[model samples]
Target chain A: MAPRNKYSVILPTYNERKNLPIIVWLLNDSFTKNGFEYEIIIVDDASPDNTAEIARQLQTAFPNRIILKQRSGKLGLGTAYVHGLQFATGNFVIIMDADFSHHPKFIPDMIRVQSTKDYDIVTGTRYSGKHGGVYGWDLKRKLVSKGANIFADTVLRPGVSDLTGSFRLYKKDVLEKVITKVQSKGYVFQMELMVLAKAMGYSVAEVPISFVDRVYGESKLGSSEIAEYATGVLSLWMRV
Target chain B: MTRAQQTVSIGLLFASTQLYLALFLQLIPLPSIISEEIIPVLPLWALVSFGSYLLAKLGYGVLTFNDVPEAHAELMKEIDLAREDLRTKGVEVD
Candidate 1:
């Protein structure tokens, strides 16, 4: 028999009190329905809204299924993943947004794709396949996203359709290896991970997913973040 | 090699080949029109075509970008169900 696989979802959050409960509930529903052995690791970086407290309440409700790792200050996303990784015991690790932008329903598809050839990483994409696309974004938002993706594809040529999408399932070993090589901190982090994984000769597969923008919190993509993303892509082009 | 190195190497090779072709055209007495008119502005033409292609691709992508209202509506219902289930399970939800 194939070895039983466990998936640990590392959800990094800040001030996501309102969305946390619903996302957790949906995750539980998805996992239960799929009959997958999984655990959720909530790595909360001290949100004033008491997101961690809600996570603690969730731990009570879900018992061993929920693992809450609270950090002191509002750290960056990369560090949050690193912190969450330390607590993940599953053979496969999933990294996704806690804001409900990346739904849990697609996790099953990602797993199925990963199993076909045992891809080292299975990433959810919004730009390829029939079911792939985004909702709740305006024309300008779509333009920016498409432009960023084209720019990255031109420069880095990572071969994956969606470079910025954060919904992904990585074999624990591949994720650990790739994360150690990743140096970018913010918006560039996801792109950098994909590029570095390709550089390290890891097999990657894509699954189509509908990315619904945040339901509760504000989704911020400021000019400064765009500038940062541009520079980040250029730097990866030079180094990777 | 890194992507940067590969790109640079390929670009340099292409530029040199174009330069050699242009020089050969000038030396070999081909039609003056072909040599002077087309060869000189070939890179510019390539650039313009590539730029247009990228623009059209981006435009088509933006035009066809899906807006799934049904997903949004379904999620709202899911949220209500989740909230009710959480409350029933003795979990306090705000």
Candidate 2:
């Protein structure tokens, strides 16, 4: 077998017990088949559910590949990435959803793009190119998602078409630098990281990926998240 | 801007208005010294207003976006715990 690339996947999951197992299986299939030495780092923010226990079991199942980094309390999403980064031991880092929205299937394409172009970052775009798509969201949901991205782009001019995508792969050092510079704590944190990345003139590549909605459970996103997203985008634009 | 600077902006606006009033009243030869001193307050007022705008943005950020002090405090606590754990294992946390 060819030497596998050490790809540390940092997954931030909050109350996602139901989705955890499936995500793990998918990630395992993707990396194992592709001959990649990967580690799954699940940062659980003291979720009220059994997410931590499930993560422990997955670690037991995968042993060397799945690493459970449990936190004491429910911290925000942005801080979770910072927490997970302390333990990420990979040449490249992958950030994505455990809710099944960011499919593991697109990850190979992302890796291929990065390898071919030698880009600093390869991000999944839902609305940018010809091939990207979104599933399971209603028309209104789509509009809200689209509008939020447009709003951030207009204010900060991040230059990336999809400024709010969470599925991305970064050079480990680049991820560290960008995560340190980013200050957003909630949903808008996703958008702000890209904005900061753009401001710092990082070379980025976009790959079209169909973002599927979670098959199980309700979405963690809501109107309140949107308000926080708006507030965060505005603050980052001014602060940075 | 500092609190003092914000007040200075309003004070400047007030003084500018007061100088105009003084000049109008001086047509009948009333006290005019107060107007000269107050008129110069205009620059201070403008300066204060600009400072206030920056302050307002800072205040908004502190309220809505990032809490630097809180995050730092939490980070320090985490470090302390990690250090203690390392000490138990005869390993330095550095």
The reply for model 2, stretches above 4 Å from the true place, is A1-4, A129-131, A220-223, B1-94
**Total clashes for model 2:** 1
TM-score of chain B of each: 0.76, 0.33
Q: Candidate 2 versus the native: TM-score?
A: 0.68
Q: State the lDDT of candidate 2 residue by residue for A57-120, as single tens digits.
A: 6666666887888888888788888888889888899999887677686788999999897898
Q: Tens digit of lDDT per residue, candidate 1, span A154-199?
A: 8888999899999999999889989998999989999999999998
Candidate number of the best lDDT: 1
lDDT of 1 by residue, B1-94 (tens): 5689889999999998977686656975768787888777887898999999999988987887777777778888999999999998776787
Provide all candidates' interface root-mean-square deviations. Answer: 1.5, 18.2
Query: What are the chain A TM-scores for all the models, listed individually?
Result: 0.98, 0.92
Candidates in order, TM-scores: namely: 0.94, 0.68
lDDT of each structure? 0.90, 0.74
DockQ of 1: 0.64
Task: Find the candidate with the highest DockQ and give its number.
Answer: 1
